[model samples]
Every structure is written in structure tokens, then in C-alpha cells.
Target: MKRHITGLFVLSALLTIMACKKSVEVLTPSGSDETYKVPQGNNDYDNTIVDYYNKYGTYMLYKFTEKDVYWTPTGWKKPTLPNGTWTTGAEVEASDSAYINAQLNLIKNKWFGFYTDKFLKKFLPAKIMLCKKVDSVFTNYVFTPTFTAVKGTKKVAAFYNYDNIQVNYGDATVNSMTAAEQRLFIYKVNLIFMQSIYARGLNAPTAEFANSADYNTAMTTYAQAYGKGIIIGYSNITAQSDWNAFITAMVTYSAPQLNASVAITDQTAAGILNTTKDPSGQIKRRYNMVRNYFINEYGVDLQLVGNATRGL
Candidate 1:
């Protein structure tokens, strides 16, 4: 009896060891063999929100790349490169080739005038227009309306279908030539364009547009600085009825979902920033909420804004 009892104890110990080994292996990443662990500690999301909105407002630009695409709609097969291929210089130029023609058509159609089209007529200094071929299998790209840059009687320097892009109007104080101004404009334009396209082309067009309120909030906040048109970005929300609904739910109709760890480039969140007052006096800033979530969840580093020439 004593021998048998001792044997049982030995077997149990071996089993426990095996189980622990398996657990350890499960926790290890296959490629790097690194232990995967989520970040701990609560982040000050509310503070981030107040600070972000107080400065950038809701109308800032956002860029959506392959990294931004996630949780696709039902029955919608996402692309391997959901963000689409990056356009080459040659391709970027080809896309711009038609800018002059498009502008002329818009002018002829009376779509633009001194008061009505004043926003579109601004000569974008050093503009980069990205476009995709028509009817291309570029669904994942944040595809939006074509953004073309045109000069008076000059051939369009750039025209291309982008997955998404945006254009914003600012007060004369926000000059396009300033680096900060340029960065802010480009980022906001890209984000706004993305949202717009998503609403129009996704599965549920109307719903997507309505649901993208948070996104719009960000744009609106950004727009306050410029004193003119709001943020405009591209979107592919209306590719299908279901997709539109999904995106809308994700944006306007949903609660603030937070991402802990988001990638932040050095350019955006570096150094002392010139936080602009929320000119509109609206406290809510969509971009701030989004950024807060990203930073809290992912520890994304945010930089401060300062002088434009200071190579932030």
C-alpha cells in the first residue's frame, strides 16, 4: 500500500509539470518566443481628451492605411492589402493628368464659383494627389472622391484615386505654406475623405454617414482653426449595405471604444506644441477620443506642437 501511494504521488507531480510546460509554451509567441502581455495600469484618457480637443479640435485630418483596416463587415471579403498599394511617383503623376480636365468640367457645370466654389479654387502649393484606376479591385483602400489639384491654365500636377483623402478650409491665419499647416491639412483631408467615401459607397450609405459622427467631430474640431470649410476625407463605407452599416456602427452609433497601443510617428506627437483653443467652443473632440484610446491601450507616444520650422 505504501509503495503504491508513493507511485501515485510521483505520477501526479509529472502530470502537473507537463501541464505547466504546455501553459508556458502557449503563452510564448511562435516566431519571437516572447511572452505576450497586455499593458497594465490605467491611463488618463479624460485628460488626453481635454488636451487634444482643446488644441486640435474635431476637424483635424487623419490618415488611414493598411494598418487602420480592421473587423470587416459580414460577407465582405477583405483584401490581403486592405489599405491598397502605395502609388509610385509615376502613378501619382498619371492620376493628376486629368486634373485640368476635371476642373474645367466642374467650372463648366457651375459646381464652383467665387462664393460657392471658393474653397476648391485655392491653389494648393505642393499638392500630392493619389488616385486608383476606375473600377479597380481596390476595395480595402480608403477610396473616396477624386481630389485633384489644378492651377489657372496649368496642367494638373497631381490626380489619383486614393483609398481616402480629405480637404479642409481654414482661416487666413492657417496658411498652407507652413509645415504645421500643411501637415494638419493633409492629415485631416485624408481622414475626412475616407469617411465620406465609406458613407457613400459602403453597404449602408445613409447609416454610415450618420454613424460617422465621431469622425466628423474630429473634422469639425480641426475646421475651427481655419475658419472656413470643414474637414474632408475619403471613405469606402458604401461599398455594400452591410459594410456601410458596420462602419456607421463603428463610428457614430457606437460608444467610444479604446485602443491601448497605437503606432504614432515622431512627426505628429513630438516636442512643444502650439495647442490652439477650440475656436468653436465645442468641448468634444473626436480625434482626441480616438487618440486617447490609442494611447491608453497601446502606449502610443504623442508629441506636442510647436513652431513649424523646428523639425518636430
Candidate 2:
């Protein structure tokens, strides 16, 4: 009995030791694992990219794959690169390496110079992809009397350009742009910024401003939809689209221009030549609301941004 009891004690100790060994093996992490690293060419442009990342947490990606741009929808198969042989799928080509520096300069002077550092850090997307071009293809099926046939088509759909803010930087046109053209480019980039801000529900106006009866009445009454509490003719379709148009106008036109637009008296059937006047003062009211919201909440004056870009 004593011998048997001693054997049982030895077995118990060995079992405990084995269990501890197994636990340690399971808990230990691999030391060789590393994350994806951005390439460093040790050039000025690469240094600027690194500086932007360090300052604003935004990756100025000029060299990236299509996976970085296209997002896989839920329950949908993940997309793969065509490897230079694609007939029906999405693809994105990286910007020309030579033009990367010029594009970076344009972004620095026009985009970063306009906004405060704090604003860019907070509002800019995590990745801003600069591409030469982006394209996608879809395959449609048609049924004939005898059999089913497939039709492959190539097109650039907005859906293919998913999460990141993509800028198509074509050739070295930055150096040749006139002052007015430069300002227009600035306006377009800033419009993207404002659109992203609105889409994310960050620093947006309240429902009181967005859904106001005065604004709605003015929008519905006017046919042209400009200078009457909205910015574009298509804005009359939906309140959300109207807000987008309003933001577009705020970033595109100066305060004086918009105010002048509201005061025009000559009437026309096509809503041009200052035909759509704001008699109810709703346009002015909503304009003030939008301007004030940006100023009070973000310490940003939308009119000032527009005015600066417009060279006012």
C-alpha cells in the first residue's frame, strides 16, 4: 500500500509539470511578427510624407496597391489584383514616381496652407491616396432564347473608390496652372474636405438649421435652387443633398458673392440672372446659421476659406 501511494504522488507531480509546460508554450508570443511598413526612399518627398504622418497622423500614400483603395463589402468576395491581366474587375495604378514630388508640393501649398494644423489632424482621413488613374469593370449576364451570355464592361464607378480620399494627380500640370486655376484646384480639394466632414457627422449643423421650415420653403419654391437657401438645382431633390450643395457653395463662393446673389432683383423664367430672390429672408438666415456653426464649433469661417481661395 505504501509503494502504491508513493507511485501515485510521483505521477501527480509529473502531470502538473507537463500541464505547466503546455501552458507556457501556449502563452508565449512570436517575436518575428511585424506590421506593414511604409517604404522610405530617404528623399525629400519621402521625408515630407513621414513628417505629415508624424504631425497629422495622415499617410500621404503615393505608392499603394488597389487593396488600399477598394473595400470588400460584407458577404462579398475580397478583390484581388489582376497582375496586368484583368478583363472584368477593379484596379488602381499608382501615381507616376516622377510627379509625386510635384503633387506633394501642390498639396502642401494649397491644401495644408489653408487649414489650421489642429483642423487637419482632427478631420483629415487616415490615408490620402494619390493615384494616376482608377478603373473598374463589371460583368452583366443576358439570357437569350437558347442560352445565357456574359457581357463584360469597363467603367469607373464611384462605388469602386471606397474609403480613402483619392486624388488623381495627372502629369506635371501643377507648374503651368494660372493663379485662377490654382485657386480653383484649391476650391476642389477643400470641397472634398467639407464633404468628408459632413458625411462623418462631425461639426455638422443642428436639425433646427437643416430642417428649418424657412429653408425648406425657399428650396421647394425656387426652380434654380441657388441663392435661395440652396446651392445647386439638384439640391431640391433631398434635404441631405441640399446640405451637401450648401457646403459646396460655402466652400466654392465667397460670402459677398452669395449675399449679392440673394439680392438680385431681375426676374427670369430659367432662374438665371438673379431671378430667384430670397423675399422671406430664409436664404440669408440659413446662410448665417451655416457660417455661425462653423465659426462657433470649429473656430473656422467657411466664408474666409472660400474668400482666401477666391483671392479676395
Candidate 3:
């Protein structure tokens, strides 16, 4: 009996040792994990991306998969059309390596050159996915006048020709863009930057502008709204709506253009000039307020950025 009890104690000790060893092995971290690793290459393009990452804390991804583009919680999935057809939703192809240098130069000259280092560091998105093409296809169903189905057809929509900051550079190379395209490119980049400012609630309108009765009235037409210090009509009158309208005005017109419009006395209709011109001095007041906010808060003039995009 004494020998048996001693053997049992030894067995229990061995089991405990085995369990502890298993726990240690399970808890150990792998040194080769690439989950958070930043990709690097010896080429100049890769080096440029690394430099941007180091400087602005932004990842300029040129070579990435479709999953990188659809990175929301739901993630990438094949879409089922209304006609009961399973279709590939959106395709985000990797950018052509040959245009990397030209693309980088365009970004540097048109985008980064417009904003100060401080502003870009603060507001730039963490990840910028550069791609050659982003396209989507949908089923186009035709219906007869009597509500009968005629036929269903698939239509392809190409979005590579435009410059979208959301997708970075599309297939349209910098050299291939026409004069109009370049202007649009500048305008879009500037517009996205302004949108980022609004999203962050940075440089927002003051209480005086946001809460003023003159600026928040319900109007039937654009002219009526302009007279009341409002630039555009709003279905929902809230602080957020007011800010959106103000931002729309900022992106739509430059300082010189606004000033020119405000000075116009000639009217296309009685008591009203063209929609682009503001006669009541109300729009001017709001413009100055918005323009001053950016200058004072960010030490950057939004009008200058606007004027630059306007090709002034």
C-alpha cells in the first residue's frame, strides 16, 4: 500500500508538469508574425512610400489586393444582383509599376504641395490605396411600359478615368490627362481635403454663424437662401446641415470669384442676380467667417487652396 501511494503522488506531479508546459507553449508569441509589418522593397518607388510613411504616418499602398479596398467590418464579398445573379462586386487592381514615378510626382505637386506639412500630418488618412483601376458591373433590367420584364443586361461602369482620393490614383496616368482633366484632378483632391476637415469637425462655423436665425431659415429657392446668409437650401435644418452648406460654398467658389459675384449690381431678374452672384452681402459675411476660421485656427488660407484649384 505504501508503494502504491508513492506511485500515485509521482503520477500527479508529472501530470501537473505536463499541463504547465502546454500552457507556456500556447501563450508564447511568434517572432515571425507579419500582421503589423510594413512592407519594404529596395526599389525607389518602395523607398518613396516608406519615406512618406515615416514622415506622415500614412501608408501609400500601390501593390495591394481587392480585400484592402473593401476593408470595412463586413469585408469583401461577392454580390448577388436583384435578378438572382451572383456577380463580382468591385475590382481594385494594383497600379502599373511603370507609372509609379509619375503618379508620385503628381501627388507631390498637386496634393502635398498645396497643404502645409502640419496640416497633412494631422488630417491625412492613415491608408491610401493606389490602384490602376476600380470598376463595377451591375445588371441592367429593362421593363416594358405595362410593368413586364423585357430583358436583363449587364452593364460595366468604368471609374478609372477620374481622380478619386478615396481610391488614390486610378488608371489615368498623369501625362495622359487632358487640361480639363488636370483641373478636375486638382479640384477633386482639394475637395477631399475639405471633406476631411468637415468630417473631423475641425474649423467649424462659430455659434454666431451656426445658430443665427438669418442663416437657418427655411427657403423655397436658392436666391431666398442666399439673402438670408445661407448658400444652399437644406431639407433638415440642423447645425450639421449648416456646416455642410458652408463647406459646399467654400468648395464651389474662390475668394476672388465670391467677391466678384458680390459686387455685381446687374440682375438677371428683379431683385436677384445670377445664382452664382450674391447681392445681399449675406453670402460675403459667411464666406469671410469661414475663410477666417481656417486662417486663424489652422494658419492656412482655404481661399488660397481654392484659388489654386481654380487655376488663378
Off by over 4 Å in 2: 1-36, 72-92, 133-160, 201-203, 207-220, 223-242, 262-276, 308-310
- Give each model a TM-score: 0.20, 0.62, 0.66
* Clashing residue pairs for model 3: none
Reference-based lDDT, each prediction? 0.29, 0.60, 0.58
Model 3: residue 64 alpha-carbon error in angstroms: 2.2
Select the stronger candidate by TM-score from 1 and 2: 2
Q: Report the lDDT of model 2 for residue 200.
A: 67
Model 1 C-alpha RMSD to native: 20.2
TM-score of decoy 2: 0.62
On TM-score, the candidate that comes out on top is 3
User: Per-residue error at 39 for model 1, in Å?
Assistant: 22
Worst 10 residues of 1 by lDDT: 265-274
- Candidate 2, 1-312: lDDT as tens digits: 999999999999999999999999888477742232444466667888888888888776776665666543432323332353224334556667778788788777777776677778888876777665544455445556645444444422111233456664535655577888777667767876777666565554568666763344434434345445554443335555655655566677775565554433332212222333665566567667766776776677777667767688
